[model samples]
Target: MTRLYSQPPRIDAGLFFLRFTGCLLLLHVHGLPKIFHFSEELTHIEDPFGLGPWVSLLSAIVAEVICPLFILVGAFTRLACLPIIAVLLVAMLFVHPDWSIAEGQFGWLLLIIFTTLAIAGPGRWRVGASQSREVRYGAG
Candidate 1:
């Protein structure tokens, strides 16, 4: 009898795909609606932190639409997570702090995942990879 050995799967690819897909989904489900609607009701209402509606809406647009798009494309993935993390923190602290887990936990979970991606980055397979190579080798 011969024993065969297989190497463990690399998690980087899975992580990259998960983060990319998750960010895209979030942008579509949450970000796009807010951006497209741009209602006074949503924006005029004072932010949870009392930052006022305009600031809140602007921040939300930057985090949900702009930053998430960068994250999905793996362009500056780590840097892009900063605004998202900020938004999530604001939500957790002011918006949904008392909400039951069943009522709303996805935002919190996304915050954690985005934080993790910030630390791990977009992995080797990312737009950043090519940019990094170009920087290192000089422009073609």
Candidate 2:
């Protein structure tokens, strides 16, 4: 039996999977629809910080779409995940708590995943994973 942590490749693969899947969920399941329907959705989304729906929707699009795409390619994985994690926190803790705990739970799960990917990185299988790891961890 081989423990997953005994190898770097396993860790890298896990990171890659997490990075790809989590971001894909944020992009396709969440962001893409809103983006495609931007005109209608612009003022309909939540204004968590009272920033107005337009600003809020734009923020969500960036966090869930632009950043996730960066994460998907490992181009700037950690930097990308930061906005998403922040948005999730705002959504789960501040915004949705007034509505329902169930909604918050989803945010929490994604928060955990993004945090993990932010910490673990996109793995060596990714485009710039090695360089990112070195810059982030001070490793060679």
Candidate 3:
């Protein structure tokens, strides 16, 4: 019996798509709005860490914006995912505790994707620091 396709490459591509799509949407759709409204939200945002609203706002911006951008580029992808995951978790539990499963579906999906990337490693495509660590297996 012969398989129809090489599995590893397909799996790697799927992982890349998952990582890129999640991070890109979160960065532009969510993070950018927060950043652009930082001053207005600073005193009003939730502070789950007891660090005050301004600090929380900044931390959230870093997690949602900076960290996701790093993950999108595959630079320290695993490490970058940690902050993103943390932000999502806090949002799930505290900021939006009333969020129904349907409403929080995307958040849950991102949590799973980030967790997967954290474990599966950042696949074969990358730039900057992680480029050296990426390994490709070609059937020669």
Candidate 4:
């Protein structure tokens, strides 16, 4: 029998899966609930930061629904990350400044993750893969 080394695969597939799952989980756990549950509250509350409730609602919808959809499909992943990053920044500065580490840490983690996604962009298997290649090749 051929000698089979004991080492695991070298491709880091688990890392890719973890990143994708983490993005989806974050959007579902944090963003989706807030979007669905807080719609009325978001509409009525006077935004203290001068963004106003309508703008806040729009931002939340974009971040929670639109961005999460894109992230799940890995379509326009970098573009989708922008709204999430903005939302996290707002949350960090306005909403949870005094919260405990567990409560507040997600914003920071999202910031880092989204920022990285924005920089590196969606990987090879994303919905945008063809578009990415087209852009690189200057095709229509």
- Top candidate, metric TM-score: 2
**Model 4 pairs in collision:** none
Candidate with best lDDT: 3
Model 1 segments more than 4 A misplaced? 1-9, 40-46, 128-140
List the candidates ranked by lDDT, beginning with the highest: 3, 2, 1, 4
Q: Tens digit of lDDT per residue, candidate 4, span 48-88?
A: 47878888777777786778677766777778888888887
Candidate 1 has a TM-score of 0.77
Q: Model 2, range 62-136, lDDT digits (tens) per residue?
A: 998999888888888888889998988888777676756574666777899999988877777876434333323
lDDT of each: 0.77, 0.80, 0.82, 0.68
Write the residue-wise lDDT of candidate 1 on 35-84 in tens digits.
Answer: 77888447454487677788888888899899988887788889999999
Q: What's the distance in Å from true for residue 110, model 4?
A: 1.7
TM-score, prediction 4: 0.68
Off by over 4 Å in 3: 1-7, 128-140
lDDT of 4 at 95: 69
Note the residue pairs that clash in candidate 3.
Answer: none
The TM-score-based order of candidates, best leading, equals: 2, 3, 1, 4
lDDT of 2 at 64: 88
Q: Which pairs clash in the backbone of model 1?
A: none
